[model samples]
Target: MLPTTRGDFWAEITQIGMDRLWMQRFHVSLPQVSTVASRPGRRSIGFLTECNSSPLQHCGLNVLSGDIIVNKFDLAHHRSGADYHLGTMSLPTDELDTAVEVIIGRELLKSPDQRIVHPHPALMSRLLKLHKAVGQLARDTPDILERPEVARALENELVHVMVRCLAEGASADTTTGVRRHDAIMARFEEFLEANPDRPLYLTEICAAIGAAERTLRASCEEHLGMGPIRYLTLRRMHLVRRTLLHSDPSKVTVTQVVTDHGFWELGRFSVAYRMLFGESPSCTLRRPAEQPNIHLSRPSSLTTAEPRAT
Candidate 1:
């Protein structure tokens, strides 16, 4: 994922796995945005647990604090505001489908699109507390999951609550305008992927992507929280930083790397780089290679239970 704003980036992620269920709680140290979807064979739910003035944009809609988002196995774009903490869970789609059939007797959702779910405040509170308790187990006492009965009990309860939220919650509808913007963003990303080595001006970007400038501007603003020009430059800046951090300073010069990423003005590039990254390009290149800052818990599974305590 590309960091939208600049700083030393680090993330703390705690993950837990049950027999057929998976869960994650993560926090990033930077203001950033990324798209997340269901894993290849799973259905996922993401909740923005904390926020203040700025609400998160989920699949092109504003998700206020305490709101949960359900991914219909579709690409869901989320932009987090500062002090963001997100919790997510996923299980096999078939498992969810069966549960909906059995419990709710009708499919909670039939559309394959990201939708927001607003549950009662008390119910939402209980879900958050339970999620937080489980995450704590993953971080501080993962061996607790080594107990078969305990793990099974927690997993079942979590699933029950999840189904209840889906069945009883008020699901928000995505506007036609939001869908149009989502399509535009898809094409825009395709263009970026197809031409990764160079920078294009706003006019050329719109022309190549087959989107009008006004429409593209609104799409970017709503989904990306920034103008097209700023988003493009910021993404490229992150790319340059990542390369510089990993490249061998002995063989490559900062000038070569910067120009390769499509920055033509060396002097102005250096200024902008320093302003965003808090360091000069050469300084970043010279630093020794360090381990990635992401902290991920080794996930636990219920199948491997330890011997019962005496």
Candidate 2:
């Protein structure tokens, strides 16, 4: 397994082969734990077994001192300036959303906006029961986790319980409270998700979101760290990547996929795709057909310790 640590923060993590689940045990005695970078399509469910500090801030949201920590996949950091211990598992987007909808209700998953849930007393009580059960299983029946059926069953239980606890704890106001920038971003994301095949410019986005050009630009830069146009470009590029990854190269070409996604300028498109995904568009297109053992590497912009799965 890869070791990730700095100062008082350290963790040993393992990925379950090609599956999206990751198990990690991390310990820290500092005021704050460093933000660990991760890809965008997952969520982290952590158990805070030990903590003697104030509320924790994760991804700019507050995580109350509790038995569970649940947040969407993003750069994570502990706001506390004191010591704490954490046990965490990562689940992919679809798994998380489905579990949440089934356990709590579909209302929570309908909003694509990221949220931090402070588990209520009732939820925490239920989590404690799950934590004991899973902890014992991890320790004494390790082989059971290796079984796909067993692991999936446990994972489903964990995801459902976590979401149920979190949603119950959250107040209606808290769940519906969208900050100014977050609201703007949500509107933009909704627009893009609905119109993935539609081409749009900055002025068009501003009008759709009902924000002025300057306001939209500032909000995107502040929340997403990019202007609206750049953000749209990157989103479109990701859509292209997804299409290429899943398409049959025998019947489809990289150029055709890009054109279908409204990427008119092929030259610049190739460069941007490479920079974002660390591979050329053609490599991605060929990947499905070739079925190479090595997949395209992740972008270098993400920082993390060595990812070792035992």
Candidate 3:
């Protein structure tokens, strides 16, 4: 677990298959944090199961019904809510293909396409059970996990189960729907990331992404549990906090950094930032390079900053 002042960001991994299969459980309580994860060394498949309501509170891109399986080819950014939680089991290039051939009788190993598959009901149930077991094993049985035979057994079981789950979930409609939602959000996120420091209105973003205003708003609300405006603002807030954490107080001012990120309403921004991150912006800016201590709970009475005349 990686500890920060706000809370602990922890991940437990069980390695197997010559460092190919990595069964992992991740959790954090940092508000408005983004995690960029990539495959280790080679291309791999990621079998992910959602853990409670932890990851959803934020506008995470991978939010889907049932267990999800994704092919990781490059770095992917995931946004987290105040309380982030998820579980993952990894499969290497060769192993994933071999498992797919053996279980589902199809070729998938060398496929570079990014795919997100949601397992059907029975398979989702099993996947959830496996997620629980992995968490329990990580917490309770470190000694057993150290045994070579036990680790191999666990890896084999995970690969087989995942293949079965994926095969069962191969419905055209479900796959198309999930892929469409993911594709639309990816476009929106890309646009926002590329224009981070600009104060472009949401309508402009919607136009750039080639979607009607209402359509984009509805898509974001359904997939991300938040509307476009709020998500963009939260993302900008996160960007400002990141800059503050990494910037030298001697070199930069909080107002300068925040304004550059398009946060025009200084008072409301401070109140929202404090509510989300549990500290004032100036505190973060003045600190030596360190992770912000985050708290999941918000202050009951948040005092807004008084707007200064330009």
Give the per-residue lDDT of model 2 (tens digit) for 211-234: 789877766655444577876776
Which sections of candidate 3 miss by over 4 Å? 1-18, 29-85, 104-150, 169-172, 175-181, 265-268, 287-310
* Model 3 lDDT tens row, 1-310: 1112243333323332223566555444443334345566544434335545444321234555464646453434354554455666666667777788988788743333335566677777776786567556655555566667876776677777777876666522334554555567678877887998878787798789887788778767655556888878766776787789889898889899999998888999899888766789998888765533332212111112111100
What order do candidates take by TM-score, descending? 1, 3, 2
- Candidate 1: worst-modelled 10 consecutive residues by lDDT: 301-310
User: For candidate 3, what is the TM-score?
Assistant: 0.65
TM-score for each predicted model, relative to the true structure: 0.88, 0.47, 0.65
Q: How many clashes show up in model 1?
A: 0
lDDT for each candidate structure: 0.76, 0.58, 0.60
Off by over 4 Å in 2: 1-178, 289-310
**Predicted candidate 1 versus true structure: per-residue lDDT over 1-310, tens digit per residue:** 5566665566566678898888887666566777675678788887865544346777568777667888763565678755567888888989988878888788875664547888888777777888889887877777787889989999888888888887788878777888888888878877876776776889998998888999999999998888888878877887888788789999999988988888889899999988887889999999975654344445562212111100
When 1 and 2 are scored with TM-score, the better candidate is: 1
What value of lDDT does candidate 1 attain over all alpha carbons? 0.76
